[model samples]
Target: MNSIFKRTYSYWFLLPAAIIYFIIFILPTIMSFFFSMTRWTLSDWEFIGFENFITFFQEQSLSIGFKNTLIYAVVTCTLKVALGLLLGVLLTSKIRTKSYLRSVIFFPTLVSTIAVGIAFSMMMHPTQGVINTALAAIGIDGPDWLGDTRIALLSVAMVDVWKGLGFATVIYIAGILSIPAEYYEALQIDGGNSWHKFWNIIVPLSRPATNSVIILAFIGGLRSFDLVWAMTKGGPGFTTDLIASIIYKQYQGGFYGLATAGNVILFLVVTALAFPLYTYLNRKEVDL
Candidate 1:
């Protein structure tokens, strides 16, 4: 009886957090699922089955949004992983200004996302922006960064990568630094070059960090909104439309239920993709 009481007392400490999580996350998620199946106003809703989802799929820009989301996720994840790994390796090396450089690289991450977006939006202006002005000085006419349909999505994606690269690098740095020195010493004794050591030891051993960066960046890219919105807002005739932006457009058009359905879809996409990738990465980590 006493042991059971003690366990119960211990669980009581978790009640506050549990209740908060249920209220904030679980309750809202459950309500979203229900609302997605209904035609809703702020005050009332009518049961409409899966009409919202059907309408969302029937949206003309759905295909574009879906494709852009996948592309953005892939490109950002690849860049972040590759660049983060390289930066982590260099920063961890015996460099004189490594500390200062690390701070400089990570500084942008501390800035607000919206602020970054707005600033870059201005900087990327065709004629008046700093980027084009500099290019003009070098006798080149710079294309409009955010105005071009062809590269607008890619432009916004590059900004996202720039903002996120620091975080990925920091993660990789931690992972790289955590590696025991004995491994490197062993490689040295075996007369292994930097390339050999990096491939055989550092790369394989840092799988966990790499996996973390990949999943995070990929998910972030898929659900990207604020940066895209601040820069392009799915502009140039929906050329830069992403899933999140499409959902927001539904809300802006007063299709609350439809937007909710889109949210549910986004949730499912994240869960489905993240779960399998996480599982695969975990297995790889274990194998390593």
Candidate 2:
């Protein structure tokens, strides 16, 4: 009995969390799968089989939204990894104001995403925005940032990078700081320059942080809705119609079943992309 209790006691500790996870996540998720297959009106649900899924694919905006989702994820993930690594390296180096700068750089991450979107939307206004006004002062006419279909998605992506860069930097900063000082000392003793030390030490050793940032930023880009909706609302003629945004438009139009189907598709797509990428990154980490 004593031995059994010892083993069973640990299970009790997990019970609360397991229950919460089921009630909050698993339950809703299961219901969503069911809801996706029906034409639901709260009181009545008509079985529709795969009609919702088929209709979702038949949406005119589906193609554009899918393309935008991939583009946004790739662009944002790339920027976060590259810029964050550089910022982390700089911040980790010897500098008098490094602490102050770190806080300043990270300040943006603390702001609400929706608020950031609204603020940037105003600043990106073509005629009277602060960005254009500043450009005008320099005798350069700033193009319509949010209104131009060609640059709309790209513009939103840049804002996303700026918003997320700080978190990535902090991750890299922590990773770099974790390295033993002895490694740097050894490199210096061997007459190695800063470049060699960074290339040989920081880059390789920071792989774990890089992996985390890529996975996180990519997932975030794939699921991003609030900022994009708040800013462009998939505007400039469906050019920025990410999967999430398209689903939202369906929800607003009262096509709950179709929207749920879209949600299901997004869940599958994110899982498919993320799992392989995560496995690949982990394998690389193990190899290193």
Q: What is the C-alpha lDDT of each candidate?
A: 0.90, 0.92
**Candidate 2 lDDT score at position 165:** 94
| Pairs of residues clashing in candidate 1 | none
Q: State the lDDT at 21 in candidate 1.
A: 100
Candidate 1 differs from the real structure by a C-alpha RMSD in angstroms, to one decimal, of 1.8
Error of 1 at 45 (Å): 1.7
> Which ten contiguous residues of candidate 1 have the minimum total lDDT?
279-288
Candidate 1 residue-wise lDDT, 124-181, digit = tens: 9999999999999999999999888899989998999899999999999999998889
Which candidate should be chosen as best, given lDDT against the real structure? Answer: 2
Query: What would the TM-score be for candidate 2 when compared with the true structure?
Result: 0.93
Number of backbone-clashing residue pairs for each candidate, in the order shown? 0, 0
Q: State TM-scores per candidate.
A: 0.93, 0.93
lDDT of 2: 0.92
